[model samples]
Target: MPGHGSNTESMETASAIVSLITASVAIWKTIDAAICSIKNAPARIQHWRAINRLLQTSLSRMEETMKRRKGAGLSISERKHYESIREHLQCFKDDLEDLQHKIASVALPRRFGKRTIPRQVLTALEIKLQEDPHLEKRVDRNIQLFQLSVALLSLLDPAPRTSVRPILTELHALHLQVSDDDDKLRKWKESAHDIAKDAAMREIGFTSSATDRVRVGRQPSINIQPTPQRDFGIDENFNKEELLHKIKVTQDLATRLEEAGMPTIASNFQLDAIKCGEQLREMHDHPLDMAEYVSLEERYILILISCQSYEEASFQIALNRLNDLASKVDDTSRNELFRERQTIGTLYAKLQDINSAIHFLRIALFDGYLKQQDLLAYDAEIRQTSRLLYEVYECSGMWPDLEVTKKRVRDEFGEDPVASSVEISKALGWCEKKGFTVSERDRQLYFNPLTNENGRTSLHEAALDPKMDMDVLRYLMLPEYYSLRDDSGDTALLLAADRSNYNVVEMLLTIPYLVHVRDRIRRQTPLHRCKDKRTLDLLIEAATRRNSIPPGTDWEPVDINSADCSQRTALHLACQQGRVDLVETLVAHNANVNATCLTGETPLVLACWAADTAKPALEAIVRELVSHGATWEQKFPVRRDPRKRLKARGFSNSDISELTRQPGSSTESSEVEKDASILMHLDS
Candidate 1:
């Protein structure tokens, strides 16, 4: 009985604290809601700053409370409640930080602060609030937790008149305010719903009457009577009309939000509308004609894609509905049926069901051709399907099947033989190099394509495979082929480098002219992409062919520390990718481990920040950098404590030439100085 009494007392105290915290959070949320609706730009920002200040105060208060309660003989539940409160406070603080950043970016007009926050920014904030459920959910949680805590406290505290009165009063006030807001929202939603429904009905009625003639005949009707209502776990008070109205209002709101640069918020509202629409369609007594039902299913698919709602259950439902609709269409409408199948395939692909995806896409091609006499007529459709299938094969690493698809696609679309022939030859060479069976048709084409504008030549594709054969590559060894740059300016060597295909890199290195070639878009060389030790070594060896310079010829070797458009060196990439072996190899080859990217992220900083970097591996890499004379004290001078060290010290933006200064000045020293000057200007 004594232990029971003590437990009761503990719970009561916890409940009181929870209730107080809940009331405070609700007030915070109320202010946030007001800020969301504020029209004046400067006033809204001022309110956000005030709210941010409040959050910081709340966070500090919670931290102090936590420290005071460290050994305060609290129950497990009480401790948990305290921890939850602290977490919610911190989350609010973080969200406010983001909100402040978003607000700061919008330019306010020179006119007096009388103008409403730019219409666009207001709309964006509205959408942001709608899309992110965290604000609403957090408030709701706080209310529930506080209410529960208050109840517990009331049970334990006998002197409730003094101990619980203020807490109860605050909580009641918050509850009333929240309920009032809900009522206003519901009323607005209902009005919007009615207007949308009227407009939609008028349009649908006109379209239906014009396109379809009613047949006067005796209709077969089922005499089935209604049984008990099917629950489907839906709310008993759920109104069909209300849901319809909400869907319309939410969709319109989302569209406006999206147009105003609040895609995330818009997406959330669209998702909400879709969920409502789905429920409306699934109601047992809902009246939808077959065509209308099919259209609704298609709409669901579109909305899901719009919202990026890639959850498997939603996709599965859409796929099932599409399949059901496809089953009803006759052979005369096989094109429609093909589209449904293709949609199903694409959805399956998104779900990572590769076999099912391939099966459905193949069915689309076959059924459209066989049933609708659509073979060459739908060649474009088939080609598109083939492209998706090829991507799936490549992603799933079904290399043989990828080769087969390539051959089949080129052969089937015979209208463009010249282009298809070149593609087929290239594909064949890649397949031969990778030891995937090359089609017999491809063997006849002896020469490679003259130009690779689209970036899919045989050598480039083959170089992506780690096991590419020397014999297959011999066919592409002509001087022109060896030196060829694709549309992206990527040579075979660059492709090999990016993939860490060691064997392929070794073979490609035979072509001396390809060693230092950079891609067109990023201007990244083979070294920039290489993250494997052996592949990097091969690239470094090719770049540093001192013997090729011929004694005292005065030609400098290639710059191993060459930077890409982003100023990222091979060391930066290696460190970023957590490639310890490559990192070591690159440093050994005189790669600048201290090199800073455009963002001022050094190799040490990158290695530390890499999401996948293992603790032991990171330690080893950091140790390697330190051994090679990296001094974080000069660049990232932070406190000795590990936790303090891990806190993001802002960008170093150190002098680049000094950061990457070599022991011996090279011919490219001028370029480094230019880069350093540009960086300084940018920094200033």
Candidate 2:
């Protein structure tokens, strides 16, 4: 039994030994796993540190390069350097991605139950990256990326308290740098704006010169300085006082001399009066009322005597002076002074100083002191004055001033002053009115006021009379009245042309705005109205003055080829007038010598029908017309009766064939001949 018991115990001890060895092997594996996990922690941390270092270096280089780029002007070489740096940063980014992939692929420690790397290790890497100067410089930009994996890991594991504070501190530092840089950049931009504005102001001719000061946001200032006074034979201040005293003494002596009426002293008085008058005349010329009333009276007296001079120019000067003095006088004194002023003005008008006459008359007309009856009593005188003024205005071509005087007279008198007349000899021995007249003399209208019908004034019968005075027409052509059309829709230009008044036509055509005016028909232009050669020549002169003409106007002569109502051109009329020279002139102007009348008759046909005595003229015109491409059919052939048809010429077959070929004519040759014959008879 003991032996058996020994065997059982030996077996049990062996089994126990086997179980202990197995437990020993299992513990060895557990220690090995714990050691392996601990060993991988530092290695993994080192890899994270390397990644952090790489990221920090890359970001720092990028930030530094950007700052350098902003502060310094970059050359091509520097830009190339930056490109290389950007490539390096991209490589760094790849490296980081690779590191992340590698870290993600790492097997979690078995003891940690499939969790990733510890949050503490990731936090350590992020905190180290934040402390790195490179990453610190761009913390705000890099922080989110830096913390991405780490923060995710932290959700799985607790984050390190030490790492969080440092990350926030680094982030704050980066924000402050970005803000400071932004503020500096903003200030620089503001300064640049101010500089640009100032440069713009300087370029626009706004300069700072004393004489031409540029006052911004203020009223313009003017600099005024007193004229320097010169001493005349006395101390400066003392001379002024002494001069005043002497003037007072002279005045007292003059008064005594005037009251005593002494013969010996009278010469001194006269001499003093002459001196005062001369000074007064000087004042009148300048029209300075700064002098006292006594000085003005002396000036008026001087003006009166000067006006009395027989010299035309001297009298004009004196008359102007009197007018100026009258303008300065008060209303109460105007009527009392009217006679003297009127005398001066009337003399001025006689001297051809119409400007002065008009000036004085305007004042008198508007003056309240003059009664309407008194003005009416002087109506003849006023009309005479206006006539003289109109004559002067006509001569001087001062239409604007003339219009002003006319308007003033119309406003005050409600009538044209030039139209009034005085009775002359009675008609046939009957009484007639005396005024400016348009009369006929030597087969031409003359502007002699002494004649019968020719002496009619323009205003008296301008609208009613057909024959106008040449001078009156010239006056009407003045700018003030050039646009005035008479009752017949005839302006001064048209009237002058109709009258064959060459001088009047010449004057009318000189007006700038009258050149293109058409008559009531809207067809007869001023150029179209001329009838006589002299009048036509005047039109040519006016047209040449400004070189103004329609695109194809022919000024060689009155183009009788020019057509009017009834298709009668100037050439047709010239032919009818038997004006052969005028016809030649018209032909030279490229006038359509073949131009047809409404009935299709040419100027040649008209001349042919007019008279056999005009046969030579008719032949010349026909030859010119044919040379200018006039159709032969425009003339007629001999008729059957030969005498009766001589007056009513017939057409030939050749003429019929030519007429058949003309535009819009497709009839048979016999029908064309019949039509041509009909047209010819209608023209005749």
Candidate 3:
């Protein structure tokens, strides 16, 4: 028993020893594992701390620079710096993330006891080295240490219970500040780009105002500058001239382009410019000399006078400039200046600026005569201009100027010394002093048989004038000039008769000798020439006087119904003119109404011809003709046999009707035989 007991005790002691050894080994392994974890914890925590510090530093620098740059107003250079910083910050963040990943993959397993540490003491020593900086009284280092400690504690199975929430909240706040600063920087950079583009646009003369840019839908706008070739000169006068020249050049270019078969897009503007230049030139060269410069000035005035609207505006401005220049010219240059003034006045007249034109003309006239001491030559154009000025001034109620112009005209031409309101007898006396002669025959002027451009006597012009004065007519109708004829063989009587001049007609009748005169048309007497009531009455009175001859008078009654060419008598003309009164008067005087013309048309046929006449007159004439036994029937001439009545029926034997039945036949015959007999009888 003792041996057994001893054996059991030995077994128990052995068992206890084994258990103690096992427990010690276990404790050793556990301590070793804890030490390993603590060792690896420093490296892991150090890596996390470095990564967090790097990330925080990068974000802090970025945020601060971004804020500073935004406050400073970012320029292009500053924006580039911000972009660099952003790239660097992104790279730093990427590196930090890489480091975190490396720490997690390589160190976390070993520190958590899943693997063995490759270098325990080195990692611990590194953590100790990092701790010294924290311990050196640096706030950032201290923060890093705090963060590292917290990170390591989090990895521990029994982590420290102390709250890390406050630290996390601070980090979050920093992140938010950085984010806001980045946003501000981005906005600043964009604005700077826009401003730079606008400046560029302004430099190009592209009207880069904000409103205009917006209107054009420009974004990130760049300014467009005008090309040097397109730049117009700065001087207003020069610009106008340049524009004119450019237009002219453009027109020429356009013409060339058209010749070349190129499009005329650019040349059209050139043409407009050329026209403007021409107008400006014209306006610049105003009043021209009539004697030495009429032809050129006339053309210039014509061009200027034809302009319309805005084109005319330039012309007006040029004219004003010319006038202004003229006003400043010295008086010694008055003669030369007067020429210019005359030209200007002429232009103004053409432009319908009558008052201004007249004003200049009067000044010119006065300068030519009074001041310049030169006799102003009488010219048709000058007289015409002066006359127009007078009329225009008169209509505008500028009577003083009108009178002045009229006096100038009279002085230049021959002045009429007779009083304007003189009596006819007094005027005649004045005319006698002027060597004017009067005739008791046709009341017309007797001159030296002066011929006009067409070789017509001057009296022809007077006769052609519808408003010719009776006194002039009387003065022209003297016996010595009664034989005068125009180029058209029109005598004074023919003219007076043609114009239906009643007063002239009566005055002409006073000359009994002219009553027997005829024109070149041959035998066309004044009585034969009457077409109207006034001339016809005069002719009738003359005829009656001739018919009621005085005692022992040698005068014989003239035939009033005498015919001329076409065998038309005075009665035919009267009827044709629808003159009922003249016709009745002539008919009462035993005038022949049935007189046939050369065309075989009687007065009755002429009266009924196509014209508007009084129905009563036509009826009376017809009745009188009928009462005179005039027949309406027309008898055809017998060109065939005179003894045979069948010739009047216009049929021969061959032309007889082929019908067997003849309802209106006067004689009976067999059908075929009757037809042949009728044909033969008709032929006979």
Candidate 4:
């Protein structure tokens, strides 16, 4: 009877094993089919890998469980428990397969009318898939499977399943989600119980009182204070006084922080100051007395100026508010309005809004409240405003406006104004004639503003000249003067790069400050203006020399990756101008190969854009950038169209396929061939 029973048990075990293997194979085939369906999608690749890892783990566990149970002659209860665990595993497999199908469906492209689903839909799907909601469900299923295995093992064996304990512990640790309120309650209870115990011990031998019974069963009492109310108008009056005081304190603090080079912290304080100023205005029902109005304008102007560095948008908004306030002022306060308009014009000029700059400057110049007697007293204002007007007029080639501005200058100041002021004479190049002593000429030009209409200081004129005066450059090469910009906002270094003055550029290299100074027009560093390889080499060498500080020093290195207003780095400019040597030089100096411009053009994209015209040189540049790890990811917006941006400043429908074409493939070459054909047509 015992031999017969053993044979039956062996036969039953083999049959069960065969059934489990058949089910396992079916589950795997389902998973594989699901994976194959989604394999075409780049976004679904990670999900497939995750699912693979999960199934791989489940297969390993199932195989191990079967191996352990193979020779073991399980009783009826143990066999039933084993079957239950196997059934749970089968359920987990089905759910996992279902999840794979759901994910695969997400990867399948959707068609709406003639056009496919928009990229935004694909992006949303990618994000949704990446979040892996199904993975959490898989983990939960894992926990259930682990629990079932544990329960089955406990029924079959007397010892704990030590192998899975670590996994279970890890899962528990990962999934533990305690609330902040729960944590606080736990801490409070411990503290309260300790205090109650201490009180009971202290009163052990004393007579028990109603309040001294420890009160361990009752909740701790907390007293809440009632806030006293004041009259609305009086409260507002108090707040108005307090708000002004707060604004002053906050402004001072922000200034101190900014001076300490903590601009981010200073911005926080500035926001608070502006908030207080707004509240003060609100307290008076938004209608200010003349004195309060003037004070508020002054406060907002200071806020606008102080916040200009890091909060430019806020500063622009503040300028708008100040302009609105100025319009409300009567003619008696017209002088204040004029000053406000002048401030706005100056800010607009600094921000490179030339049209607005011209508009407000003209208003500040021609329409102030100064009477004929007081006009001479405001002579400095008239000259300064007229000078700015003349500069802009010259830059924009407004010849009629230039003549009008020249007349305005002579009418406002005196005729021969350049000769009357020694500083102005030197700034206008009047002192550059053969007779003046070098020291005297330098001194005269020292305090002159580079934007002065009178021909700017000889430094700017010499810097732009192809055959530059080396002696004059060395004489005026003081560090303080190196960053001075002309009317067009081109510094001496920028002028050299603009005109490709290699010799003048070499002279300016000794002063490190000149190399990093950005011109106000485009906020471009000198390196940004380099259109040739030789000039770029000179600038790079200068930058390296400047940055080669000894270890442990407090000097900041030159930012080779520093971007202009358009966010084009030095590398972007070098590649755009088709200087391969400069591109390689910039890359060697650690310029980001993947640095993008405002229009999402990488050095590679820019290089590729010109592949039709300058194929060999640009192809070499493209190859160099790729080897340096340049990617095709567009980091900035070019347009609403999904097509890649071209160098021609226009989009072509065929360019999209060309951009997305596989690099080094015949398709890529064909696109370039087509591009060449298109170019020929356009040129003709």
For all predicted structures, in order, the TM-scores are: 0.32, 0.27, 0.27, 0.37
- lDDT string for model 4 (161-244, tens) is 222222222222223322225432233223322322222222331223222122232211111132445556434455666766
lDDT measured at residue 521 in model 3 versus the true structure, 0 to 100: 70
Q: Ranking under lDDT, best-scoring first?
A: 4, 1, 3, 2
Question: How high is the lDDT of residue 505 in model 1?
Answer: 78
Candidate 2 residue 406 Cα shift, in angstroms, is 15
TM-score winner: 4
Q: Model-by-model lDDT, in order?
A: 0.50, 0.40, 0.42, 0.51
lDDT of 1 by residue, 1-684 (tens): 324433343344444444555555555564455466555456424434333332423333433343333323333333344434434444444554555445445455565365454553564455556667455444333333333233322222212212122222223223333333444333322332222222222232311221112223211111123245555734244677787777677777665643432233344566666567667767778633344444444444544433221122444554564555455533334445666667667756654567877877777755554345546676666666765665566546577886776666555554322235555566465655544433434433344334343455667767766666554554444344555666666777777788888877776664443575777888787888776766776677567542233233222345678888999887887777878887766665446656777876678777777768776677566656643434353334233321232343322323222333211111222233222222212212
Please identify which of the two predictions, 1 or 3, would achieve the higher lDDT against the true structure. Answer: 1
RMSD in angstroms between candidate 1 and the native structure over all alpha carbons: 25.0
Give RMSD to native, each candidate: 25.0, 42.6, 50.2, 23.1
Clashing pairs in 1: 15-149, 193-245
Poorly placed runs, candidate 4 (over 4 Å): 1-43, 46-241, 256-268, 278-323, 329-336, 351-356, 369-376, 412-421, 424-525, 528-684
Estimate, for each residue in 98-198, the C-alpha lDDT of model 3 and write its tens digit: 33333334443345554444354334334444644432122232222222222222211122221122122222222333333455334433432333233
The lowest-lDDT stretch of 10 consecutive residues in candidate 2 is 422-431
With a 3 Å backbone cut-off (N, CA, C), the pairs that clash in candidate 4 are none
Cα displacement (Å) at residue 116, model 1: 63
